[model samples]
Target chain A: MNPVVLCTVARMMAPVLLLFSLVLTVRGHDSPGGGFVGGLLATAAFTLLLVAQPEELVRRRPRVDPTRLAITGLLVALGSGLPALFLGRPFLTGLWAQVPLPGGGALKLGTPQLFDAGVYLLVLGTAMAFILGLLHGEEEEAREREG
Target chain B: MTPPLLLTLPLLVCLGSAALAHLCPRRAWPRRGVALAAMLALTAVGLLLLVEVRRQGVLAVQLGEWAAPFGITLVADLLSALLVLIAGVMGLTVVLYSAATLAPELEAGAYYALVLVLVGGVCGGFLTGDLFNLFVWFEVMLGASFVLLALEAKQEQFEATLKYMTLSLVGSAVLLTAVGMLYGVAGTLNMADLATRLPGLERPGLVSTVAVLFLVAFSLKAGAFPLFFWLPASYHTPPVAVTTLFSALLTKVGVYALVRTFTLLFTQDVGLTHTVLLVMGGLTMVTGVLGAVAQYDVRRLLSFHIISQIGYLLAGLGLLTQEALAALIAFLVHYIFAKSALFLVSGATARASGTYDLQQMGNLYRSHPLLAALFFVPALSLAGVPPFSGFFAKLALIRAALRAEHWLIAGTAAGVGLLTLFSMMKIWREAFWKGHPQDPAAKQEAPSSVNVGWGVLGPCAALALVMGVLGLGARPLLELADAAAGQLLEPTGYIQAVLRRPP
Candidate 1:
């Protein structure tokens, strides 16, 4: 099969994996799974796409930088602390809210879950950065030659 | 602001700075400015902690009103808060140094980001009241450090980081598993609650096992004798600024956690903890100085000394007295600043000479007399020379140990101090006095003097001066350290502080 077709197939599966990861994360407080394992599953889905496609597709993208992923994760995590600060609670205090989903049912989201996702993205991005940076070394012509 | 909020504000600032830093353009100076501002804010928080600790006995902040045993808590006693203050000072110096010394292609933005997270994690570890929270903070610091270790991506860095990552991951896993087991048996993760509840529970074997597991994890992080190979290998690869920060702070955090836990929750097992600590302390001091004796590189020698100095802190904790604790705190504060200053000077030396290896670097006393003098005082201080902070710190520890009648350990530590002097003098002889043979190509390749920013040097010089002042102000600080240590050892104070009533 052509690599392009293989990649397209994996792209279609990414959302399903992501949804499952969220489910696992939501249930993690009482269950065996938490942000780390759930995040790994989501990262693996992205990794599958990179393997199927050319390196350039992943390397040249703007948001793929591992450092940025880490930064974003930290921002989300810190934002979780904001509610606590205003309410005079401790840092990383879990805040709660209920909102309506599109299907007329309530969805629960909390600061802990948001913090979980941030950790997920942070770890995934960090692991991916190391893997991708190594794989894409050939692309950094100017960087290597300078050294 | 409340004490917990005081700690949280710094993390929040770090988080914001991490974002603002990453958003800066690749060629921009804006990221450095933002990081500097964030660091200044953190220092302000540390100062606030000082004022709070002086006013109140110690401060506590519980999350979500769930109370201890159910919710996490953050505490800042004099000991932890003082360490936080030292950490903030070290961080600001390193950031200033980084702005000046960071080589091109080092990804300055990412470097600063990692530094911020590492700082936040260390402070978090210092403040958290729950055991599980402590484990989480340890992983946070280790994970950030792992990235920083491997970020430069050289051949040696790959091998070194892989070693560091594997060891750190295993240590963290061990730590988390121990947390799980402690939670299962004790049914609580809060440190104060554990202290009150633990001695009453009758399961000595399980407690001992969990304690041992924690010891191994912390020892691995502390780079104690048997577990120290990773420190020497990985520390020399990073830019000197990063190495300086890591050398000054990382393992010391491990030592702090060990001192905290053993003093608080595991005091019932004093015979076991004290004996093990004494033996490890003796071995670590000897082994570290031996490693230093064999090294020809300036940074590697300093790296070895870090492990040796940790042995001193362990010895103080093992002695387990008011005076010993005071000495440990004093020594650690002095060591953090002195060690970091020496490393920054090494960066300046490396820039001028094009190598950190002493074999390649000779006679620096002539051209760079100021830099030579800058490195000299810290080296002497580290060796425990009279009138320096190291001498006072050692004298206090020895006095405490003798008072406790641990003659063998005290004698061994003093002997190791002599070896410490020997290794430092070796560097002085080779790097500053003997001098390098001039090479035209190497001179052309030398890092620019602009890279050795006065902003960086000024902080380091101020830090060294501060260590001297700490010796002068030793009485009040010693009183505070004794109070902190008493709180940790007895832990009834901490338990009451958190339980909000008598147990």
Candidate 2:
């Protein structure tokens, strides 16, 4: 079902795609990209790897269950809103801070960015769960047929 | 507590419990404990909110510290607070019931988490101040409900869920379209802002079109006529506990949205918009009762009754008088407790008789007198009999209709009450009064002798008792409903509170 060339390309591109997704997620607060898009990109990367090597990926399950990961991400997103309440602001009021970078530039950080990170994780986990669930179903059917 | 914190606490408790339950898949006690504690916390929050809203008039908070008309707002007027309180109580009771009756496999599959999410969504829907936020909450509720409907599903359940899912998605799309069009017209999504802006818009006709769209979407959700085919089809498919939760909260949320929007935002043309609701409500009643009359299955029959009762609610809304709205709120409170008790009783009845079919079942009055008593209180109440909340609820609605001089709807309301009584009597005769068809002596061992545990019967008894209390002490609740209706009729205070204007 697979071509050698396709497998090799997927293996090589997956890591690069993941790194690019992180960049997109972090830069989302100021510009066009955000958590949703970045999460989809990361899912695409994982999807490529799974499609190229379904057996290996399925056999060696990820350390964190996708469902739990998604739940954790949701908790993180909800938690991000709590800090403002502590500060006597509204539930989701964004608070910002500036960090002095080693390169002498100030890095702007905010709760919204943290929120986007949570969204990133949630979307990634949910999508992966959906894909992996389908793969497992197909695998079970195939095994049943063979047996 | 601050308004934002108070408003968001139920949602936080629910989501937090959902996560906690999801993380501990193997530990049954921890999951149950968390779910129980979370619902108790939700109930406490709901009580606090009700008291606060009663004292403070309307409580509004702008999330993200944004000014009104821009940021998402959470508002809890009396109506919202009351509905939240009902949802919290319903969640707690259903959790207790599930602990006894739910299958082990389903419980392990994160059923509690799903229920918590669904309750949270209902609370959010009740409390949200923005139109788009209402839509978001609807989606959240739908998402949880879809999984609940299909979790450990049978073939019939899968089919029913498909129908339910398709219809609900269409409703959501229609709702989103209406919201978008309204925003494009009014330049705001806040309910109060929309209320103010919609009337001032030059094109009253365009506004009415959007209003009708909102009506259709919410009508579908409320299980109103011509759009309620999904209810009886899918509702009877889920397990009893799930069915009870859905019966108690889901369509009522739809009714809440209808009352909220029509009274607040679409009053510019009550003659046009509400009249449509009036006609729809009447048809919904007749059709729903007739559907019940033809059914022999216990759950399906009760499902039809849900639609019929919804008709009374819509008719009350259609009347649009202060008295009618008050009656509607009172009716809603009565209906939730009564209907949930009925569903729980049906589950227990099925357990005792080994069948949901009335044709095969009988002698429940002889076999289980307590179950019969549990059944009678709600059944009589539902039939608008005296000494129960449903009677006062119906009486108030009929009086409101007569006062408004809506003679036709008034007649329909009375006639429907009679039909409701007929069906309740039919159930009583078939399930309890008559002897079992196959076992004339009614001594044969029934299948599935697993006793309906206290966990199952206790909530039913508690809910039935609540109906009794609400009926006997209808004075206080009537006053509360009257005040809530006053708020709905004159939304100026609501608007001022949300917009931070001096009133």
Candidate 3:
């Protein structure tokens, strides 16, 4: 019945769900999952946040404006493409660069995977932003009439 | 990298702009800019693609280099490039008009984001070479469209959108099922590969069933005749800019895919498919014009005309000649500009007078001479009046139909053009000249606040001007359309261009 505890629990799961979404996106090229499904999963995490938080508090705060989150994801995606332009390739050209991870292993980061991450961010951000914006507007309008 | 990157730019611009719009201090400015930038970027890419296709002939990008059957491919030929260009131009005009009028009322970034995704999906549909990928693009575009349509979600809009959504989902499901069955039969999702695999398949009934499913799915989306009831109900409910985008672009995506797949893969079964198309085309034109006659709303009337005009394009596909195809392409280009301009004109009028109901719009000719002309000329052009792009477009289609001895199609085309003029005049009489009587509910009450900013009117007037210019410069476009049609007839150039492997 304590909303703060519920909100904290939801917030704690956000990171875990976000990490899972990343995993889905990274292995997407080789597996059934891709950016779209991953994005939806991430959006679910945010939806949970809304559910756990009190509606009144959530309404006042303007939770992670979907529009802004979508833009940030797009920027990351666009940023990944900048490396291609530097290499004298066209915009959004996918380039794979292998980075040496700790313990004598390598981590591979590339334009395509980054693009997927961007897509994940975009879908999640847009979906949640739209859902909340709509919910907030209706709630505010109702509150005004009641007052 | 080049092909895929160019294709992805529109999507990026669309998604990126929406994201950025939220950060803008003046939300209206960013929303407008996002739409404007996305439109300009798409048009520029289209031009670049046209030049590249001309120089190199069909350009293909194997997304992730996983090869054709395994990975997705974006293939651009003269027709696909031309369609993308048309989408870009229409998008630019609608977005600008939206910025001027609707953006202020909209919840900033979400509206722009949905629009961007819609644009991205259209480009994907135009460029995709794989059957499965085409289905994915279709879903992407339709999903975004549902959000846009239901954005307002008034009682009427909710009703219309629910019907639209249910029907569209059914179409998508049928398309997915067909794709699944095709994959089972051919062992590949690549369209060209499917074509190669199809000739040897022994199951005629299965192929026929699948082909019919494709027709039903595309025709439903295309708003062709029987499946078109949803278009009139829903298109007019949204703000003018949204209506213009959907009316001009979305249905055309269905028509484009239908023509592309049938031309390339299902050519062997044209006897059944073409006959179906021809019958639907005739019914679509007659019924569409009839619907237009019955409607009082400017946007709904234009929506009806969209179905009639689409009928002409379908007629061309049924004929399947080089000339017919050329004429269809030319008509489509003209329709995109003209139809969008007409809707924008309606939006401008609504903003000026605070009503979409034609019965209420009064004496616009006196108060706003420029706006009246802006709306009038396109209405005339849409009716296929002489010296306009619509006239030339109709002339080409008529000539092609006659040459092929498709007498019914030729007669129906001309008849529909006349009916189109009738509906245009009805709007002219009711909205511009006589105007609707003051509403008792709102008459005594001060008029609803209307901000007729330059941001809105300027874009609409500019688009109307472009329609006139496109009408005037029909010769060059006609030649280009002919060339594009010729290329589609022999798709060897497209296949060869994409398959330019290391050897």
Top-scoring candidate (TM-score): 2
- Candidate 3 per-residue lDDT, tens place, B320-433, comes to 999999999999888888888888888888878878888878766555667778887788888899778889988999999999999989999999899988888988887767
Scored by DockQ, the top model is 2
The DockQ-based CAPRI class assigned to model 1 is acceptable
| lDDT for each residue of candidate 1 in B1-503, tens digit (9 for 90 to 100) | 87668756655676577677776776437777777888888888888887787678677777656676677777778888888877788888888888877765564437877888798888888888898889888888888898898787788888989988888888888888889998987989898888888888789889988888888888888889788888998898888888988987899889998898888877778899778988898899999988889999888888999989888888888888878887888788778877887888888888766788898886566656677778877888888887777788888888888999999988988999999999988988887777355643433343233344475567667767876776667677667767777766666666767777211
User: Lowest summed lDDT over 10 consecutive residues: which window, candidate 2 chain B?
Assistant: B441-450
Chain A TM-score of model 1 comes to: 0.72
Q: After superposition, how far is residue B430 of candidate 2 from its true place, in Å?
A: 1.3
Worst 10 residues of 2 chain A by lDDT: A138-147
DockQ of 2: 0.68
Q: What residue pairs clash in candidate 2, if any at all?
A: none
Cα deviation of B27, candidate 3, in Å: 1.8
True contacts kept of each: 0.71, 0.77, 0.29
lDDT (Cα, tens digit) per residue for candidate 3, span A1-147: 887888899989988998898789889977878788899988888788778877776657744556667778778877776676555444555788899988998987778888888888889888986777576677645753453
